[model samples]
Target: MAIKVKCFASMREYLDLSEREIGIDGIKTVADVWRSVAGGKPMPENTLCAVNQSQANEEFTVNSGDEVAFFPPVTGG
Candidate 1:
């Protein structure tokens, strides 16, 4: 199965890319996707995730053709 990953805000800087597609075998969750793209590095704490534009947790199941996005926690004055 294949999934599209999008990194936003500081996540883009951390990952050093805005978007990319990855192929995986066997069952995988949102967290797994993050790890796969992270290249053995740990993900930032409090990072937020969404599946197909809807908020999702790390345990969220990822399916083929799904668009998963990661964002750093938002901050405001």
Candidate 2:
């Protein structure tokens, strides 16, 4: 299966990437995608995620050609 991964805001800098298409098999959930992209590095806490533009949780299952995005927690004055 192929999944599209996007990093936004501070996540882009932490991941050192903005977007990528990854090919994998037997992978499930947003957390799985995070592990794949992180390459053994720890994922930041409070990271927000979306799948296909809708908010999703870590347990959200991902399908082929699905777009998964990660964003750092938002803060404002």
Candidate 3:
């Protein structure tokens, strides 16, 4: 099984990927998903995430076939 990951805006640049599929083995929470693909880099404190389009925290459990998206907080003038 696999989880689809999407990085948006600045997060996409930071992660060097807009989208990728990751194996779900041993991945239980959204944090695990990040750890598996973050290449040892720490997640920014202001980063936000969504699971299946609904807002989720790092501790949110992720199942196989889930879509997880990460993005930096949005700002406007």
lDDT of each: 0.89, 0.90, 0.95
- Give candidate 1 regions above 4 Å deviation: 75-77
Poorest lDDT segment (10 consecutive residues) of candidate 2: 22-31
In model 2, the Cα lDDT at residue 46 comes to: 87
lDDT of 3 by residue, 2-58 (tens): 999999999999989899999999899999999988999899999999999999999
Clash totals in order: 0, 0, 0
Model 1: clashing residue pairs? Answer: none
lDDT of 2 by residue, 23-66 (tens): 85866999999988987878777889999999999999999999
C-alpha lDDT (0 to 100) for residue 2 of candidate 2: 88
Worst 10-residue lDDT window, candidate 3: 68-77
Error of 1 at 30 (Å): 0.3
Q: Where does model 2 exceed 4 Å of error? A: 75-77
The estimated TM-scores of all candidates read: 0.88, 0.89, 0.94
Query: So what's the TM-score on candidate 2?
Result: 0.89
Which candidate number would show the highest lDDT if scored against the true structure?
A: 3
Q: Which window of 10 residues has the lowest lDDT sum in candidate 1?
A: 19-28
